[model samples]
Target: VALALCVIFNNSPVGSAISLIGMMLCLAGIFVLQQAHFIAILQVLIYAGAIMVLFMFVIMLLNLKQGENEGWASREKNLLLSVLTGFLAIGILYKISQVLFSVNMDTPASLPDSFGTVAVIGETLFTDFVLPFEVA
Candidate 1:
């Protein structure tokens, strides 16, 4: 429901920019909640702070107006496709959840202070996934 409101606001130019900023912050909060502090901070600094600011400035400079929204009513074929996609997504998620929760993994009693910190994440990324990081 909150997301729908955000999207509705996003139909307006200024509200759209604010909505984008809010989305970036929300995503950062999710990252933090998932124990990915390094990613969360980077998401805020890079996406929410720098990129979104640049986007807002460009939109303001352009003085963009809201365009008419297209495709409010769905066709029968489109509705069928949507239902198929939804079921496929649900099936995939169910399979993944089963795999993930099938094993009873032991929980760690405590994490080091450095866990999910920027420095530690950087070290791990460079050491363990240097090639993929560079390619990306």
Candidate 2:
């Protein structure tokens, strides 16, 4: 959805911003699915909130106008792209089908019960991730 918005509405800053927000939410959903609730919340709060606000501020301050968003290719080129995309989609579906036949999908045995807790994230943030966090 986000990519479609970006591609189809290249002339609109609002469209790009909305796409960015959608991407952030999708990332947050992936984090939640991975049991990283703290990271998911932070993703929405920091990247979606603060960074998006900054981007909008920059866009507003620059007073940028919409640019040309015309397609560069002819109908034949578009048809070729459509065919390639169809093949890619079929390949992706095939990979997903293979997952159903797989037998090994369990979590690693070394992962602790506290792996996804706020405390664990906090500890790691203040320790191993401290330098990068500070730099940021």
Candidate 3:
């Protein structure tokens, strides 16, 4: 919802950036509630802190100003983009509907005692995702 509002306020660059940060923070909170503390910390530190600061810096550095009555594009281009977006949205909805109708709501399998433990997660991270994890 906050992200949708941010997109709606595209004319205000600083406001949009601020709202984007708010949305990231909200996601971090959700992660915390899901017991993914490391992911939550990463979300706040990497997304809300570092990336947003860069975005704000660029916005300020560019000194963007919106002109009165200015459109994002000419009418023809806007119409083309709207048509494309509508088609994309329809495709996504169709895929979602298919999944919803076809899903089998079976009883979930039981998890092992070590499932979601820090040590287990750490082992998988170091073993399977070493390069990408180290790069991050």
**Residue-by-residue lDDT tens digits, candidate 2, 1-136:** 4355354545567668768877888989999988899999999999989998899888888888865656554565567667767887898899998986774667554767898998887898899999998998
- TM-score list, all predictions: 0.60, 0.72, 0.58
Clashes of 1: 0
Ranking by lDDT: 3, 2, 1
lDDT of each: 0.77, 0.78, 0.81
lDDT per residue, candidate 1, 1-136, as tens digits? 2443454534566777688788888988999888998799989999989998998898899998756666354465456656766887799999999977886668645777788887888898999999999998
List candidate 3 segments past 4 Å from native: 71-119, 131-136
Q: Spell out the clash pairs found in candidate 2.
A: none
- In candidate 1, where is summed lDDT lowest over 10 consecutive residues? 1-10
Number of the candidate with higher TM-score, 1 or 2: 2
Q: Name the regions of candidate 2 deviating beyond 4 angstroms.
A: 1-9, 68-85, 104-111
Off by over 4 Å in 1: 67-109
Pairs of residues at least 3 apart in sequence or in different chains that clash in candidate 3? none
lDDT of 1 at 67: 67
By lDDT, who's the top model here?
3
